[model samples]
Target chain A: MTYEVYVNVLPLKGLLDPQGKTVHQGLNKIGLSQVADVRVGKRIVMHIDANSEEEAKSIAEDACKKVLVNPVMEGYEIEVAQNA
Target chain B: MTYEVYVNVLPLKGLLDPQGKTVHQGLNKIGLSQVADVRVGKRIVMHIDANSEEEAKSIAEDACKKVLVNPVMEGYEIEVAQNA
Candidate 1:
C-alpha cells in the first residue's frame, strides 16, 4: 500500500530561530505590526511504499530521524495516512 | 481569544522546486533509493489575537497570501483552532 507521511520539523523549543526572527522583523517593517511572532517549520509530504500503514509510519519516522531532522537543534513529528 | 493558525504552503503543481530537487539528488547519492519523491512545504504556526475563530483564520489567510506565499508558484491552506 502507498501511504502519505507528513513530517513537521520544528526548531526545538527555546532555540533561537533566526529565519523566523528575520521574517518577524520584516513583517513589522512592512506595517504588519500585529503579527507578534513568526515560527517557520518544514512540512514534508512523502509518499511511502510499504506493506501497511504501520510500516509506512515507521519508515517515515526512521527517515526523518536519521536524515531529515537535526536532533541537536530540531524536533520532528510524523503523521501517516493512506493515500486517497 | 487567541487562536493557533496552521498554514500549509505548497508549491503549485508543475512548478519546479529547486530545494526539493537538490535534496532528491542528495538522497539518491546517499542510497535512500526507495524514496520516490520529496515535496517540501512550509507549515507555519501563528498565534492570532482575535475575537473569534473566523477572524483568526482570515488573518492567517491574509498573511499567507500577502507575505508568506508566492501566488504565481505556490498555494496555501490554513486551519484555525482556538488556543487552550
Candidate 2:
C-alpha cells in the first residue's frame, strides 16, 4: 500500500525563531499590514511505500523520532490517509 | 480576490537539523529500513484576503521575508493560486 504523510516541524514554544521574526519584519517593510503573527516551520509531504496503514504510521513515527523531529527542540505531527 | 497559498519551510542546506536526524534514527528503530532520508520542515496553507493574485503574492512574499522565515537559517516557498 501507499500512504501520504504530512509532517510539520516547528521549534518548541519559547524558542527564538530568528527566521520567523525576520519574516515578520519583512512583511512590515513590504506594507503587508494584514499578515498577523507569522511563524515559520517545515512542512513535508511524502509518499511512502508500505504494507498497511498501521505499518506506515509506525514507520513514519519512527522516522519522526529519529530523523524528522528533535523531541527536545521541535515537535511533529504525521497523518496517514485511510482507505487510499 | 481571495487566494490559496501553499508554503514550504525548510532548513537551509549545510545547516544541521537535529530534528531531522532524530526522526531518521526513529525510523530505523521502528523497522522502517526502506526509508532513505528524513528532512523535517513546515507546511502552511492559508487563504489570503487580497484584491488580486499579484497582490497576494506580494503580501505572502513580504510575510515570508519578515515573519514566516528567517533569512539566515531557513528558506520558504510560497505559491498562490489563481482562478479561485
Candidate 3:
C-alpha cells in the first residue's frame, strides 16, 4: 500500500524565530499590525510504500528524525493516510 | 475576535524542487528509497483580528501575496478559524 504523509515542522515554542520576526516587522511597516504571533515552519509531503498506515507513519517519523526536523531548533508533527 | 490562520506555501507543481531533490537523493543513498515524490514547502501560522472567518482568510491571503509567498517561486493556501 502507498500512504501519503504530511509533516509540519516548526520552531519550538518559546524559541526565537528570526525569520518570523522579520516578516512580522515587515507586516507592521506595511500597516498590518493587526496580525501577530507569527511563526514560520516547513510542511513536507511525500509518498511512502508500506503495508499499513501505522507502518507508513513510523517510517515517516523515522525519516523526520533523521533529516526533516532538527531537534535543536525544531519540532514536527506527522499524519499518514492511504493515498487515493 | 482573534483568528488562527495557517498558510502553506509550496513550489508550484511541475517546478523543480532542488531542495526536495537533494533530500530525496539523500534518502535513496541511505537505503530508504521507498519514499518518493517528495515535495517541501513552508507553513506559517499567525493570529489575526477579524470580524469573521472570511475576513480573516482574506487578510491572511493578502499577507501571503504581499510577503509570505513569492509568486514567481511559490503558491499558497490559507485556512482560518477562531482561536481558542
Candidate 4:
C-alpha cells in the first residue's frame, strides 16, 4: 500500500520568524494593515510505500525527526491517508 | 472578530520543485528509500481582524493574489477559522 503524508513544519511559539516578519511588513506596506500577524512555515508532501497506514506514518515521523525538522526551532504535524 | 487563516502555496503540478528534490535525495541517502516522491511548499498563517469569517477569507485571498502567490508557477489554498 502507498500512503500520502503531509507534514507541516512550523516555527515554535515564542521563536522569532524573520521571513514571517518580512512578509508582515510587506503586507502592511501594501495597505493590508488588517493582517495583524503572520507566521511562515514549510509544508512537505510525501508518498511512501508501506504495508499499512500506521507503518507509513511511522516512517514519515522518523524521517521528520532525523532529517526534515529542526527540533530546536520547529515542530511538525503529520497526516496520513491511503493513496487511491 | 479575529480569524486565523492558513494559506498554502505550492508549485503547480508538473513544475519541478528543486527544494523537494534536494530533500528527497537527502532522505534516500539517509536510508529512507521507501519514500517515493516529495514536494515542498510554503504555509502562511495569518491573524486577521474582520467582521465575519467570509470577510476574513476574502481578505486572505486578496493578499495571496496581490503579493503571496505567483499565478503562473504556483497555486494556493486558503483555510479560514474563527479565532477564540
Candidate 5:
C-alpha cells in the first residue's frame, strides 16, 4: 500500500525565529498591524510504500528523527494515511 | 477575539523543488528507499485579532498574498480558528 505522510517540523518554543520575525515585520509594513505574531515552519509531504499505516507512520517518524528534524532546534509531527 | 491562522504555502505543481529533492536524496542515502517522492513547503502560523472567524481568515489570506507567498511559483491555503 501507499501512504501519504505529512511531517510538520517547527522550531522549538521560546526559540528566536528570524524568518518569522522578518515576516512579521513585512506584514506590519503591509499594514497588517492586527497580526500579533508569526512563526514559520516546514511541512514535508512524502509518499511511501509500506505494508500498513502503522508501518508508514513508523518509517516517517524514523526518517524525521534521522534526517528531517534537527533535535537541537526543531520538533516534528507526523501524520500518515493510506492514499486513495 | 484572537484567532490562530495556519497558512500552508506550497510550490506550485510541476515546479522544481531543489530543497525537497535534496531531502529525498538524503532519505535514500540513509536507506529509506521506500519513500517514492517528497515535497517540502512552508507552514506559517499567525495570531490575529479579529472580530470573527471569517475576518481572521480574510486577514490571513491577505497577509499570504501580500507578503508570505510568491504567487508566481507558489500557492497557499489558510485555516483559522479562535484562540483559546
Candidate 6:
C-alpha cells in the first residue's frame, strides 16, 4: 500500500529568517507590497508502505517523531492520502 | 471574507538538500530506516481577504507568480480552503 504525507517546516521561535525577510522585502519591491511578516517554509511529500490505513498512520507518525521533524522547533501533519 | 492557502516547497531540481539527506540518514539509524532518498521541503499557510473565491484565487495566483515563488526553481500550489 501507499501513503502520502504533508509536512510544515518553520524556523524555531525567535530564530531569524533572513530568507523570509528578504522575500518580504522583495514582495514590496514588486508592488504586492501590502504583505507584511511574510514567512517562508518548506513542504515535503513522502510515499510510505503499510498494509492498512492504521498501520500506515502509525508508521508515518513514528517517522515524523523520530526523523521527519524536530518537535522542539518544527511542526508537521501527515495525511494518508486516500488516493494512495 | 477569509481565504486559506496551502503551499508546497521544494528545492531547485539540481540543488543539494543536505538537510534532507541528513534526516534520511537519521531515519536509518532509528530503524524507520527503510526510507531512502528522502528529500525535504516546506509547506506554508496564508490567510487572505477577498469578496469572492475567484477574486481571492486571482490575487493569490498573482502573488505566487510575482513574489511567493521563483518559478524557475521552486514550485507551488494554492488551494482555497472552503473551510475558510
Output the number of the lDDT-best candidate: 4
Q: Tell me how candidate 6 scores on lDDT.
A: 0.66
The ten-residue window of minimal lDDT in model 1 chain A covers A27-36
Residues A1-84 of candidate 1: C-alpha lDDT, one tens digit per residue = 677778888888799988878767776677666667678899887777787888878878777766788999988999887672
Q: Model 3: residues >4 Å from true position, as ranges?
A: none
Cα-based lDDT at residue A34, candidate 3: 77
Q: Could you give candidate 3's per-residue lDDT for residues B1-84 as a string of tens digits?
A: 899999999899899999888878877778787897788999998999888888888888889888889999898889886673
Compared with the true structure, model 4 gives a TM-score of 0.96
Candidates' C-alpha lDDT? 0.78, 0.69, 0.87, 0.92, 0.90, 0.66
What's the TM-score of every candidate structure? 0.90, 0.58, 0.94, 0.96, 0.96, 0.74
Candidate 4 vs candidate 6: the TM-score winner is 4
Share of real contacts kept by model 5? 0.89
Model 1 residue pairs with clashes: none
What are the runs in model 5 whose C-alpha is more than 4 Å off?
none
Between candidates 2 and 6, the lDDT winner = 2
Candidate 4 lDDT over B1-84, as tens digits, reads: 789999989899899999999999999999999899999999899999999898899989989999899999899999997683
Which pairs clash in model 6?
A: A42-B41, A42-B42, A42-B43, A43-B41, A43-B42, A43-B43
TM-score of chain A of 3: 0.92
Per-residue accuracy of model 4 over A3-84 as CA lDDT, tens digit each: 8999999999899999999999999999999899999999888999998889999999999999999999999999997683
Question: Is model 2 an incorrect, acceptable, medium or high docking prediction?
Answer: acceptable
**Model 1 CAPRI rating:** medium
Q: Which regions of candidate 6 are displaced past 4 Å?
A: A10-22, A34-37, B11-19, B82-84
Candidate 3, residue A54: the lDDT equals 88
> True interface contacts reproduced by each model, as a fraction?
0.55, 0.39, 0.74, 0.85, 0.89, 0.42
Tell me how many residue pairs clash in candidate 5. Answer: 0
Name the weakest run of 10 consecutive residues (lDDT summed) in model 5 chain A.
A75-84
lDDT preference between candidates 2 and 5, better one: 5
Worst 10 residues of 2 chain A by lDDT: A33-42
